[model samples]
Target: MSAMGILSYGLTLCFVLVTFYFLRRTFEEKKPLVFDGYYHPEFKPVADVFRQNLLNGKERGGSFAVFHKGQCVFNMWGGYADNEAVRPWDKSTLTMAFSASKGVAAVIVAKMVDLGYLDYKRPVADYWPEFGQKDKGNITVEMLLSHQAGLPLLDEYLHLRDIVDNPDKVERVLAAQGTVWPAGTDFGYHGVTYGLYVDTLVRKADPKGRDIARFFREEIAGPFELDTFINTPKSEYYRAARLYTQPMWEMLLETLMSTRYFPILGHYILFPDSLLVNVAKAVVEFTKDMSVFNNPDLREVPLTSATVTSTAEGLGKLYGILANGGTAENKVLLNAELVKKLATPLSQGTDSVIKQENSMFGPGTVIMKNPKGQLMFGHSGHGGQVGMADATNKVGFMYITNYISINGLGDDPRYLDLENALYKSLDNHESNIGNQNI
Candidate 1:
């Protein structure tokens, strides 16, 4: 045989072997993931449904956890945490649960409200006196949480770093803008700013004036005994889930135009004057080193919206508190009355840009209100972390996917909109059962 022909054959043979090796590594699975301690009588059906619907590898990867009566009835995750990891996505891998972390921030703020340190009606200026400047003095804490504070996206100039490490950077950027409309006359989604609101409220209220990351530790996250956290620890670095993005985002230059798939890193851009939210960002900027991100100290930096990582158990536990009447063990996270307040749907208006009708501005959460007024409130993190609980049914749940997004929707190919649809299903099902029981 000619030398060239032989070389070509050899190259093709090597490629085939490499492909087979990876394929075998991916498909060969003797160890079924530890989904639950044991099977549940009720969840056998539910598990079958999730296995058929959410799992089965149709989606890039996804997982779901359901907490019934404060117990995890169904918890399962199966897929690649990273396509390269060769490790199965398990219960321990944490995803950045996007806006869902805002729900967490809301809980922290609500705790302060419960302690009589804050009133939603109070002007933000009351605490941070400088916030009163630039006609912002009248902007209420409640308005900020509800996304009706009249500031939507941050000024375009600032990047994620400006918000994380610099003090007064976010405030200066935002305060420069005029209100979109008079504050509180109409409602819009705060998106990223929601984290800033919650963070600000927590700092103003905490005796030590703790920032966002610490609030997660001292109040909501650490207290819940979940692995979830806004700022990831260097010690826990090995277990942290790595992230990937849709191709469009990776394709763009730093100054490139936005696309449908461009994940607003830190959830909705590096909003400036986002006092609380950026303080919570603990994401590893690059490599395995936790200190790669701007703030290495968990106490100093915060990226409340886009940075926290959590397992299903941790998120479910936090939601369990909201599902229950505001108490997780000895700690009373919020008053029962406040959970009602938190869940109360703000007036629905066109989202500043997303243009969805179903979105309702709640503190940290977007209230899932159906046409019939059946309500289920939970938070969704940036990638595929989803948690929703129907308080009326006393069920709280969490689903975290290391595969953040494939198309515009989460990585799950099962239902393009499964995050919202499943939530609606839980609300509808519970409402029907309630009506029948009554």
Candidate 2:
């Protein structure tokens, strides 16, 4: 045989062997998935659904936790944190909470308001003078938190470095930017800008001059003994979930073919802030391709609107505090007055920008109104994570997942199923209590 032909045959043999090795690894018998936290008997159906999803390749991995009357009643985690499924998600696993961190940030502010340190009705300019520039002087803290400031999109293009690392430069831009609408007339979801606004406001308003990151560590995370963080520390890198995006082509295909997938992207194009929405979409598209979310530098930097890392248990406990009237173990984190203020709605109906039906807001939290007019408050992240409190019932529940869906607002069925199951459990508990009382 010629020398060239011999080399070609050898290369082919090597390729086959490498392919076989990986195929074997992929099909290897998996260990039985287990959860570390205490599981409630009533939640068995929920757990079974999750287990089936994992087995059927419908889900990757995630965690769920719920608290009732200031105590954790259910905690469970399963599936792989990594896309490869080589590592199982355990008690120590932390995943990005994305927009849900807004709720946590709001809790911190509520604490300040409870202590009479910050006022919601006061103009943000009262605290940060530079923020008053460009006719933003009238924008109150409530307006900004409720996404009514009309500054949702950045006027200028911001590189990833600017968004992730440099807060000072971003502050300068915000100081000079004018609102798209009158300060409180309309509402929009401030996708990336909310964090900068909140952080800047919090830093200046804080008596200690502590930024959100510092304040969260010293006050909220430490005192509450929560595992959540606005900016994840480097030492905890090993525990953080490595994120994976569903293929862009797959998503685009669904948008084109599926009736259910159509409105999500369509709404962004049809909205009043379509230009801003397009620009924001472009920025997210740019980041997704580069694996920017997994960057160590990016993860460590505080982005109160996004980039929070926590276990379901941590978020659940935090919400549990809010559910139980903002007091945990007799330690008052948020007083009764502040709790009332936090529940106050800032908007009357569907948000103009977010297009969410009948959504309301109170500072940083999402106020969900039921048909009967009762309000349930909390926040949901970009993927499938949700942390919420039903204060009337004194219930807190959280669901976190690695499998990210395109529309996180209300489109993901997986999260909706879990939520329904949780509410059903709550109803059962309430009935039992009533029976016992009778």
Candidate 3:
């Protein structure tokens, strides 16, 4: 062979070897960002499975936290916050935990009830007179929180511009829409509408006229030193997670067919004559573009029902307080009586909005049912985020992620695996609830 040809062949061989090395490294398991906790020896498998999930590339960016009796038992994070996988997810990374915001919003309202400013049995119109319009004067606060007020859908479509620029107009429209069913008759998931209602009611009921966003900041998030937020501040914007959008074909299929992800519009498109089709139509109009989640302006708007930025630790801490009878950091945040009410189930059965069976709801929270079919109070977000408090077990569990998934209604496999680990770990402790105020 000529000397020039030999040099070219050697160069090609070097290139192939380098490419192979990189490929092997890409397929290797990634180390978790943070893993700290004390679990029984038996719970090793739980940690192993969690690590295996990252190694298998099933997760992108996320965090999981478990608090037993106000003490953090397990806290773990892995993956990247950005879609480009350049930024490693860490203790500070935050994302929109979707419906988990509902649980936090409910906690604020429950505190209001504890302070004697609101009553679940009283008509919501008693505080906000305008809300009494359209024969809604009799809808009680409890009924609305329990997803039973029957005003889950809006009669008119809403643009994001309207929700951001002129919430009052949207509020007025909500006040005027008649309930699809009589108040307290049946139940349906209110989806995004509940947030608007709760926002309006909290502002009216608050003596200082603070809106839900402000109230949560001053009363809950700030006082508790939580990293969560209803309207994420500008300074924290850089730390927000950039979610991975689903494959185009999958998104289109879900947008056209699934009610859980697509909201009311998908259902209306699939079954126009079905019950609550108008609600679906309204949801479709509001969510006409899923790009809204990717917009930076989303952090500026306070969509408490679905758009609160939070971490697993933040969510778990909040739920841990609730699980410990509303006391955290030696502060009595909620009265025991009110805590009991929050834990009580207000509605159960097939949810009209999601079209799922055995779904349970409480005021401002999604009461999750375990594999055993027993209801535990908490909430799950649209992607794969979930936060739940088992008062009986004194366990507050949270899982947050950036790798968006479609199995939103407590069926996500990652959530199930973590949930199983949580249950098994419970056997290692006698009872942590007695000694700690957390």
Comparing candidate 1 with candidate 2, which one achieves the higher TM-score?
2
lDDT of 3 by residue, 1-438 (tens): 999998788567656655665676688665545434444454566666677676666676688877778887777777788746577887888888877778888898998998888998999999999999889999999999999999887877665446669878888888889988898888998877888788789989999998787888888888887888886667788888887755554444444445455654456588876655555355443354444566777666787777788888888888888888888878887878877777788898988766877777888788776655556788887777898888887778788987776656766678888788667667545444333545
TM per candidate comes to 0.73, 0.86, 0.84
Model 2: per-residue Cα lDDT over 1-438, one tens digit each: 999998788567656655665675589676666545676776666666666666655566888888899988788788888756478898989988888888888888887776677888899999999999888999998888888898877676555456556667777887887887888888878877787788878888899988788898888889989988887788898898888765564445445444655665777567745744543542343335424677877788777887778999999998898888989987887887777766777875766665566677888888764223468788877766778888888888788887675655634556676666767776777788789999
Which pairs of residues have clashing backbones in candidate 3? 264-280, 265-280
By TM-score, who's the top model here? 2
Better of 2 and 3 by TM-score: 2
Model 1 C-alpha lDDT versus the unseen true structure: 0.60
Rank candidates by lDDT, best first.
3, 2, 1
lDDT of 1 by residue, 276-368 (tens): 233223222311232233233432246665566677777777777778777766777677898888787765666654444556667656676
Q: Which stretches of candidate 3 lie over 4 Å from their true place?
A: 1-44, 249-269, 273-291, 371-374, 431-438
